[model samples]
Target: MVRKHLLAIGGALGLGLVSAGLAQTIEGLDLGAIQSRAVEQARDAEAFLSAVSDRGKDARDEARQTVDESLAAVKAIDPTKLPKVGEAGAIDLDEMVSGAQGSLDNPRSAPLFIAFASLSMPEDSLKQMIADVHKAGGVVVFRGLPGNNGRMFAAAMRRVVSQDASGNVAIDPRLFRAFDIKAVPTYVAVSTGFTPCDDFACKSRVPPFDRVTGNVTVQYALESLAQAKGPGAPVAGAALANLVRHD
Candidate 1:
């Protein structure tokens, strides 16, 4: 039954109908919510594995695989709940790219800051930030991390947005490679989509980019990124700083 349903979903996606249904379904699935739930499930699985004494290494590996597959299934449904790539009033990446292509035909808009990490940020903080972005007419896309930290983070985000109705955020790993991230906890504001206005004109202002290490927190790093834009951009700088301090 699950396979059949998945197949139907795939068909829908292929037909471009998935986007229409996605926005409505995504209203309840927020990034923070999903990650929290995934973390809990992973802890439970760990406890179960620890209790299984005398199990061969192969057996344990198989059990872990089963757990992972179950988790993946849960995550698969997330995208459907979000709005399609070009829904009106929604910050659709597709639309952004299209508009960018036209406006930045010469030089692109400022690069978006991309962060890749394995661990989830605090649920309350992350969710609130996501909510703020949504209210500000922005979109967030969460991708799966590589190791335990990644899984836990993915789970937590899943829990927060599972019931979302906007279909604004997404959690997928495929998009990660496209950004060419080097470290687990890294941020890079890219300029891939925006084209320069002309040979000498830039589309959006490019901000300074830097990386931090150890005990890294999402809110703080995001705040720093916003601040890099300059003090005059009160909305981004002030909002991010407030979130970091509060978190």
Candidate 2:
């Protein structure tokens, strides 16, 4: 009877071990529903990332197009409105002084004179002189000198006269002549008929001082002219003398 009881006990322990093993196997298996849900979540995340990337690309394309359009608009602006050389701008003394004729019928309308050794005068001084002439209701004619300073002097005159729009000053090389120009940088004032005159004379009257030095400053000449009395004399001789001295 004892042997029969031992066999039954061993059989019962073997059946309990088999049932534990089967329970462990069932717990390890993956459910189809859980796997399907995980795949759907992964697909949603991928779609969200793709949409963000596409939006960024679209924004970049729009920005590029906007920049291109802006550049095109700038390029399309009209260039004619800008100032150009040789346009109907202010008259330059250099260009005008050339090809000038001494017989410019309208003397009072515009002052004309043949500059002797014009290149000897400084550009600033010449410009100032031209401005003075303009202020005195006259135009200037810059005649070319035989020396190398001709072009340089004319250029200086051009720089100053170009600032005014009235075209009051002009330069003309054609007016240059080999006359007895006793004084260099001589300024011969003219009247309504364009006739040349000195301090005391307009129509063949003798100048008070006939022998003026070529190197004499404008101040010296004006002072001498102020002391004399005649036609073509300085309008306000004393005032002009004072102005030249101070200048």
Candidate No. with top TM-score? 2
**Residue 105 lDDT (model 1):** 33
After superposition, candidate 2 runs with Cα above 4 Å error: 1-90, 93-117, 145-154, 172-179, 189-192, 195-220, 234-247
- What tens digits encode model 1's per-residue C-alpha lDDT throughout 121-205? 5555555545544433333444432232322332344444322313444332322334444455554444233322221111233
Best by lDDT: 1
**TM-scores, each model vs. reference:** 0.35, 0.37
Q: Please list all clashing residue pairs in model 2, or write none if there are none.
A: 96-171, 97-171, 97-172, 98-171, 98-172, 98-173, 100-172, 111-139
In candidate 1, what residue range of length 10 has the lowest lDDT sum?
9-18
Backbone clashes in candidate 1 total: 56
